[model samples]
Target: METSIRLEQAIKKLYIAFHNNHLNPECCKQCAVGNILDNKDSWKHLSDHHGSLELNYVGKVHESFGRKFNGYSPLELLKIEAIFLKACGYQLPFHHKNSKPKNPTHKDILFDGLTEVITFLCELDDVTNIMDYTKLFEFKNDKPLHDITEASA
Candidate 1:
């Protein structure tokens, strides 16, 4: 998929994830990029891993490039949020269920943090070892494994 299309889908998922997570819409306003920045410490763990220091630093440094936006627009930042949510298996059309996969769990939050950090690294132009980090962001295909054609009434 094209990067922009993927980004759009990711953004929609993020909005849904945030809502399903019970985050205040007023605080996030359908885009929680500012909320993430406001709670940077919570997200710091995303890059706390030993080898992730470089990747984390690269993101921050790149963030510095755009004085007004921290090197990314609000949409771009939201895209990162979407990437994080997706990494933790946040699919669309959220529904109430009696079993697992109902809402974002604590584990999902931590995984999201890690995903955000890794995605930042992936966006870097200088990074050459993308394969190593790509796996961290992998997600199962959302499309059904089997196709079912519609049946005429």
Candidate 2:
């Protein structure tokens, strides 16, 4: 179990977790994310899952076909999350959210930011609770942690 700080990887984990019943719409903050991942088109305020993404609705319709794969732009996604966490009141079980650094880098910081998110999710459900932070391995390539079979077998 390695800590997974990569945003794409973290989203991958959530996508897998949601599909596998490790997460529930009633508990997790990402049901909308899962909906987008699954290619469903729907409009609902962020309130149901705890209202983390209502970043000033100036007629910006947030919909994704799940074709784009990555649910939200790294910057957009993290900001929405901050809103979610703020709405959640930054209380017990979830660690206090950190203000993201302003310096820019091509490398994604959202990945690193997910550690706290996973922690927050864990506080909400069964799937998140068992997420071994150590199991999130990192590699600098486009390869799946290992060949598919090698990883599972």
Candidate 3:
């Protein structure tokens, strides 16, 4: 329900990118973190390699200074991109020789990537996964779980 401003903004951007055919696993400006950062590829400089968890010198300096782009640390942006790429079926450290989906832009492939990225974002914000619907099917004492809605209200 209650989400950080940055998380909410990031989710909205991702949602728009997904539906608008703007999400791309291979394009730095169209990837998950890029979309979250308003289609900017500057986040790529945070790491020496795409999908790498280690921060480069510039990234380390930003992290040390508490610099946040779009409310996410440089390291967080790298992690988000890594998660998206991995879930989309790409081998880490994205190289032309690395394994990747037959059609990286396919809706199914993008959806899978977005799902994982969203889950990671939720974890970062310490919030329930917005895409998770498992709670709607929950049951207790052989009765449907109806208390969540009531509690939310």
Candidate 4:
């Protein structure tokens, strides 16, 4: 099967399974509290003048970046993104049960950001070894698998 089709199918199954009821959170309070960590002032401070802080262990490094967001460097942007991802339960320490999967034990289901998942999966597959990029991105040269069939070459 084409990578795009397979990806879509896999994602559909994942969502269907999740919707049927299968996953749950490992740490409700931690995840929830982390969700709204906007107020830096209330956080446990770590730095001096800059007043930097640690959001979630080593996974996130929140810093002032010395200027406004527009002035953020590449490294600083990376740091900010990392913190947000961890806070949003992306690279979570534990597996949460899906409250809506057919197979409640199936934790592979994800409801948001298939592109990110596809990208990560491609990485985990070790891109150098993947001859079939078609089966990785779940898209055919940027277009979807179904669209490929529906449209002509």
Candidate 5:
């Protein structure tokens, strides 16, 4: 399926980060949006608090002007980070009192976060979730509803 250049690039970066063990929920420079932005923590300045959906003054101005970092708006970046953090088991607006996974860097934990982020990215691009496998289980008359080749198309 066709995807925006930004989406494709973002996905590629995320995939690499995931496999390279560079993804971390607590680090602004290594989170999902961070990797998409080339591991920069500058996006953190767009919001006053980490994992917050609300935008600050700078973020508002950038959003109003249609500014995009690595092809994502300031708001989109915030949403992506929030999603990642939540999926990784962190409470919103990350803080010392917030509950989080005991092993934040665990592969399974990171994978869960990556799954959600990829789903969101696909939604933004109006494409099917690349990580979805339910179609392979669909059946009609006890036969596979989607052939492997057709599903891959």
Candidate 6:
């Protein structure tokens, strides 16, 4: 399957968000989920998996969907966002609260989300055969660290 530019951008943004949250959680307070919900310009290129289904109201309409949280943490919101994004065919994964992590830490939530994003990208590249391996290396070596989660200008 030929990958779309939109998907490519989305995947890159996911990576950017993951590193941003990992390196500076304070700056990226909301992380990827916050970026998805609050920033329309950045995420508008990505398409929804379920057409006409409002993300905010998904739990209300679908019995399988989890209920909304009034004051959820950034990690919790990220998991919910992953669920909806995955349902929309983005290859994302929702980390259920039930799963037991091996090594628990204050940053465990961010790490879990990062793992999902990387897995999604790897699977996407395997299917589409479009990933540039060197770009990741370049990103690691050449890209200056920044607090902003958005891709380098």
Model 4: lDDT of residue 76: 39
Ranking, lDDT, top scorer first: 5, 3, 1, 6, 2, 4
Q: Residue by residue across 42-151, what tens digits does model 5's lDDT show?
A: 99999999999999999999999999999899999999999999999999999989899999999999999999999999999899998999988999999998899965
Whole-structure CA lDDT of model 1: 0.40
Instruction: Give the root-mean-square deviation of each candidate in angstroms.
Output: 16.1, 13.9, 2.1, 14.1, 1.5, 12.7
Please write out the lDDT profile of model 3 over residues 28-115, one tens digit for every residue.
9999998998998989888999999999999999999999999999989999999999999999999989899999999999999999
Selected candidate, larger TM-score, 4 vs 5 = 5
TM-score quality measure for candidate 3? 0.93
lDDT of 6 by residue, 1-153 (tens): 575453455556555655654322222234444443433322211223221123333333332344333333223444445543443333332233333234322355555554554455445445533333343444446674443346444
lDDT of 4 at 90: 49
**Per-residue alpha-carbon lDDT of candidate 2 for residues 50-138, written as tens digits (9 for 90 to 100):** 33444334213333322222434422443435533333334322333543234211123333333445554444333444435343454
Better of 3 and 6 by lDDT: 3
* Reference-based TM-score of each model: 0.34, 0.28, 0.93, 0.24, 0.95, 0.31
**Poorest 10 consecutive residues by lDDT, candidate 4:** 27-36
Task: State model 2's lDDT.
Answer: 0.38
Best by TM-score: 5
Ten-residue region with minimum lDDT total, candidate 3: 143-152
Runs with alpha carbons beyond 4 Å of true place in candidate 2: 1-80, 83-100, 103-108, 128-151
Among residues 3 or more apart in sequence or in different chains, the pairs in candidate 3 whose N, CA or C atoms overlap within 3 Å are none
Q: Per-residue CA lDDT of candidate 1, range 7-26, in tens? A: 34434444454556633212
Clashes of each: 1, 11, 0, 21, 0, 1
